[model samples]
Target: MPSTKIGILETGGPPRELAERFGDYAAMMRRMLGEGYAYATYDVADALPATPEEQDAYIVTGSPAGVYEDHAWIEQLIGWLRQAKGRAKLVGICFGHQVMAEAFGGRVAQSDKGWGIGLHRYQLHERTEWMDHAAAIAIPVSHQDQIVELPPFSRIVGGSDFCRVGILAYEDQPAISFQCHPEFEPAFAKALIEARRDRLPDPDAAIASLDQPDDRERVAGWIRRFLDGLAAERS
Candidate 1:
């Protein structure tokens, strides 16, 4: 196997100063994905990729911007996604997940159930070759939007009470998306939870929940296998 280069489509970032200290989502992804993969980040929130062929694979990061927002960049990103279609393996996290859902004819909105912060457990309902384990896995989550409908040719892989479309794969597309953040370290999850503490419905509870153990590494392994498998299939 030759070297693999993956593109990080950065939709948003933490506070500039905090991002400097802790690094951004792209950096976190690189750290988790290890050295076998080379990464290039396109601040798609700021600028869209010049061409769909620029990146071999793409990982869309979480964002503060809602998928339903009237943003040109968001539209551009979706257009790029449509262009790439089945040509590349795409993975989305949090906001990325929501946007992908919406772009694929599904719907995404601010959940009436409210915000989900800290560790969340999603039960794996369907198994694919990309996953090594199943049942239930706890992962760091920080999102208010939820995927409410299934797109054409979509299959649900995992879910829970809070988020029905927790994990999904398109039958005709080379893509998998997660509603949780496997790239998030405990400290980063804690920091994000704390930063939004005042806005959260239960600050104390959310803070306390951060201490709970998570399956971050396990989820990371799943993502790694999924992408690697996609690459192999393509090759």
Candidate 2:
């Protein structure tokens, strides 16, 4: 059997240390999907493919930049997503999720409520065939911006008090968006926190909180199950 080729649209703002230590997001995804799966990354903010014809799946990764930033390629990416909505399976994480929402007639803005960092709990409001298997899970979160409003026909799959639109699914389409960064491990998250420590309100507290191993494992389990669900749905 041929390998499944997944397309990854990386927004390219990852810290150099974190990227070097954890490897690229595509590498982590390849590990998650096991063998018989491969991924290719594209800088959607720079260029996106003319079509999704060659890929089995597509994922949009997180970025430090906001979706509303004045970038020419960002508009093109939104257009690409609109065109490929139902034809392909799309998973948007962090900035990708925000961009997808904005692209699909939703709104994204920086929260005056401050950042949602460290491990957080999210509850699933209603059971769906896609996320019913894992209703409530504690996932890692570290975002300053969020999707304030959802696009047409989007359903809330999961959420916390800080983020009402944690996980969203497009109506009848095999597309999913996440406000948290499920791709991050504890080490990677801590690395990021340390790198951006000066900007945080309480950097010491945040680092101390992330020192626990159990929380990291729990979050990892949640992500594994979530990704498993996606793969099952596609199959």
Candidate 3:
């Protein structure tokens, strides 16, 4: 009956100018996770712990950096994940998702299709006990890199035409990942799209996509259930 300890591996952040104006990624996560659980953020981009026993479960945050980048902390995180080897529950989002896929023998690369910035829908092809619904879920997205080849142990549970490997779960590992940003609220998502409007290949389209309603809280609820389920399994 104790509170769950969740380790948040902070990878990267938005522009300092924007973060000062709109809050950082960790703040969004704290809002999504609410008050029941305790979160300890290890700025993995800056430093990783000497041991993985720091928390009961782990959730890697999305990063602007690519998994293919030659960052020391990224490599270190991958090594830590290799060591974890299903010892604890690990949930990944966006860049975190890509890194987990890469660490587990999958391939991640910049897509030829260009930036995926905006609201997108993914069909839930398979359902786990953690999922409250099997219908499509709409979430904000902002990545061009994707998981093209999955690890042998991974199963594709959800996807869309925009991203084939939208969601993945490992058969042999206590892990799950989503390609979209469920932690992103409407205001943040709009600001992010506006912040990088010129850089995007289709900024107008991206802006237009924001017209759709978001289901951020719903996805966050499912993620909470998933983490709780992971805890229950070991208990």
Candidate 4:
């Protein structure tokens, strides 16, 4: 048997201290997939391979940038996603989720309602084998943009009051997307909130909300279960 190859699409963001301090997403993925898996990171906005045949699966990371921005590379990545649809497994987080939606003919825009930050609870839309144990999980969300409309054939799996399109999956594809940052841990969430405290409406309130221990564990468990499901599918 050969080692499974996973590609990570990274978006430019905070310094190494802040990004790496949160725990590397690639490392977490490797741990979840076990020893026979290798991970590679690609800066999507800078350079992305012309083909998806290079990796077994792809995981797109969160970004501070909006999906609607006029970035050339963003558009290129969206095109690549369309081309690779159904041919490979894809997981999109935060900005990656929004980008995936737009690539598949959905609409994404800034939330006029305001920012959805800190730990937020999302209710599972329906019971599915993919999310057998996920119900109301408190996941950390920090985003200004939201997917207002999903493309045809996409199922809304989970959502919160602030973000109606929290999680989405394609009907005939192995792609999964989350508007919330499942990659974020409690400490990272706190650090992110602090870093953007001045821009936030209520910084103190956000920081105080992170003290909930139950929410932290629930969110972490939800993420782990999700990854496990993907790993099981590969097997």
Candidate 5:
């Protein structure tokens, strides 16, 4: 068997001051997922892949910008996602999750719940084969925009009351998205909270929450299984 080629679309970057310590989002994701497949990082700000099938699957990284924002690249990315549906597996984290929702007929807006920074737990909604029988998982979250109306032809697979649409699975295509940041480790999550001290209401509490355990690796496994499952179906 050949190594799977996974395309990583980097929509944004980490705080400039923290990049030396934590590296970029794509680097964090590669480290979190470990080394089982061939990975390529594409800065979507420059250009999207010529074809959706350019890779076996694609993982859209989190961003600071909102889907509703009037950025030319963001709109192009949404269009690419619409075309990529079913052509290849798609996974989104945080802002990527929000963009995917907006692209697929769902709605996203500044959350009334405020900033969802720190480790948050989500209850599993179904025993999807890729779920690996896990009942619940806690991962770091850092987003103000929430998916209010889930996209068409999709089902909620996992999430918490605070973020009801935390995890979504598509019915018509091999795509899924999580509103949590499984790529953010404790140190990075803490730093992020500290950096956003001015915006968040209670930054100290959010930073302190990082001491708790998280399910970053577990969720990465879920993503791997999901992409593998899609590959098997096509084979």
Candidate 6:
């Protein structure tokens, strides 16, 4: 069989200094995803894919910006996602997750809970075969926004008190998204916390939490198995 074509729809990236050390968000995702598949990246600030359906699947990367921000490219990306739904599989992370929810009749905004850093745990509500039947998970997270309202036909995969819409799977679409960052290595997660020390309420605590065992590979497994399902279906 041929390699699956995976597109990286990048909306934002790490700080320039941190990126030099940890690689950009796309690179981090690629490392987590491993090899054997082909990848194409589109910097959404520059442009979205001319053909949304060209890739067998797309993994939307985390961004520093909010989904409600008035950016032309951000709006365009949402429109493209609407067109791409069901045409190709999508896996959204952080901002990607928020944007997908906003595009699909949901709402996203800065959480009153403030910044959520470190490894946050979520109770899995329901599991599909692709999820490997996991009932709970704790993955790296760095965000101030989350999906507050769910889209129609959305199924809850997992959630926690801090972020109710942490993980979601659509009933009528071949798509799923997570508010956590499975792509973040412990080092990168720590560095990100340190970089934003001024903005975070408890950077030291957040950085300390990174030392605990996390479910990075566990979430990555869910993503890999979920995406691998697309290979057999794609032409």
- The local lDDT score (0 to 100) that residue 224 gets in candidate 1 is 84
Candidate 1 structure lDDT: 0.84
**lDDT per residue, candidate 1, 162-225, as tens digits?**
9888999889988989998888887877877778777887766766776888788877877787
lDDT of 3: 0.85
Runs in model 2 deviating more than 4 A are 212-235
The pairs that clash in candidate 2 are none
lDDT tens digits by residue: candidate 4, 56-141: 77888777789888888888889999988987778888888999999998999999988888877788887544554556777778
lDDT of 6 by residue, 2-108 (tens): 89999999999999999999999999989999998899999999988888778999999999899888999888999999998788999999998989898888999
Supply candidate 5's per-residue lDDT for 51: 99
State in Å the error of residue 167, model 2: 0.6
Q: Spell out the clash pairs found in candidate 4.
A: none
TM-score for all models, in order of appearance: 0.94, 0.87, 0.94, 0.87, 0.95, 0.96
- Candidates ranked by lDDT, best first? 5, 6, 3, 1, 4, 2
- Runs in model 6 lying further than 4 Å from the true structure: 230-235
lDDT of 5 by residue, 95-206 (tens): 9899999999999999888888888899998867777667899899999899999899999999998999989999999899999998898999899888889989788888
Clash pairs (backbone) in predicted model 6: none
> How well does candidate 4 score on lDDT at residue 72?
87
Candidate 3 — which residues are off by over 4 angstroms? 230-235
Q: Where in model 5 is the C-alpha error above 4 Å?
A: 230-235
Which digits, one per residue and each the tens of the lDDT, describe model 3 over residues 1-235?
Answer: 8888888888988888779976788877888889989888889877775666677778889998999999888888999888876777889999989999989999999999889988999888977777765478888898999999997799998889989999898999889999999988777777888888878877777777877888888778878988887322211
Question: How does model 1 score by TM-score?
Answer: 0.94
3 or 5, which is superior by TM-score? Answer: 5
Over the stretch 43-119, how does candidate 2's per-residue lDDT look in tens digits?
77667877877676688888788888887778788889888887777888888899989878899999987888876
